[model samples]
Target: MADELVKAGILSAPEEIDKYYLHGSGHFIGLYTHDVGEDPDNLLQKDMMFTLEPGLYFPEEGIGIRIEDTLLVTEDGCEVLTADIPKTVVEIEAFMQS
Candidate 1:
C-alpha cells in the first residue's frame, strides 16, 4: 500500500508511511463501530465480519482519504456490504450533484 502511494508521488520516503497509518488497517464491526475478537496477526476465516479501511493523511496539503467497507469472508473471496456507497471521486461528485 505504501509502495503504491509512493510510486504515485503522494508520499516521499518509506519512513513517512507511518504518518498515514491508522494504528491498524481496520477492525471488526458488529454491535459497535469497532467490534471485538479479531486479531490483527491471525488469518481470516469464513463468516468473519470486518472492515478494510486504508487512509492517507497529508495534513500539510490538507488532503486525506479514507475509504471503508464492511466485508464478509467467504470460501473464494469476500463480499462488500457497503458496495452501494459511492466511493470513487466521480461517483461521489455525481451523487453530490443529485
Candidate 2:
C-alpha cells in the first residue's frame, strides 16, 4: 500500500506511511472487544468475525476518510454485517439531498 502511494505521489516515503494511515487493515472482533485471534501467522481464517477497516488521514490537506465493515467469513465468501446501512456515495448524497 505504501509503495503504491509513493508511486502515485500521494506519500513521500514508506517510512512516512504511518503518518497518513493510522489503523490496521483488519482485526478480530469475536469473544470480546478485540479477540487477538489465535492466528500466529497473522492470516485470516474461516468463521472469523472481524472488521475490515481502512483509513486515510491527510490532515494537512484537510482530507480524512475511514471505512469500517464488519464481516463474517464463510465457506463461500464473507458477509458484510453492516450492509443494512447505505454507504455508497450516490446513496448518501441522495439521502442528504432529500
Which candidate has the highest TM-score of all? 1
Candidate 2: tens digits of C-alpha lDDT, residues 12-89: 888878998887787789788777877747766678898888888998999888778899988888999998766789
Model-by-model lDDT, in order? 0.85, 0.83
lDDT of 2: 0.83
Q: Which residue pairs overlap in candidate 2's backbone?
A: none
TM agreement with the true structure for every prediction = 0.82, 0.68
Tens-digit lDDT track for model 1 on 1-98?
Answer: 88887898867977779987756778887789898856777998999889989887877888888898899989998999899999999999999999
Which residue pairs does candidate 1 place in steric collision?
none
Candidate closest to the true structure, highest lDDT: 1
Question: How much is 14 displaced in model 1, in angstroms?
Answer: 3.0
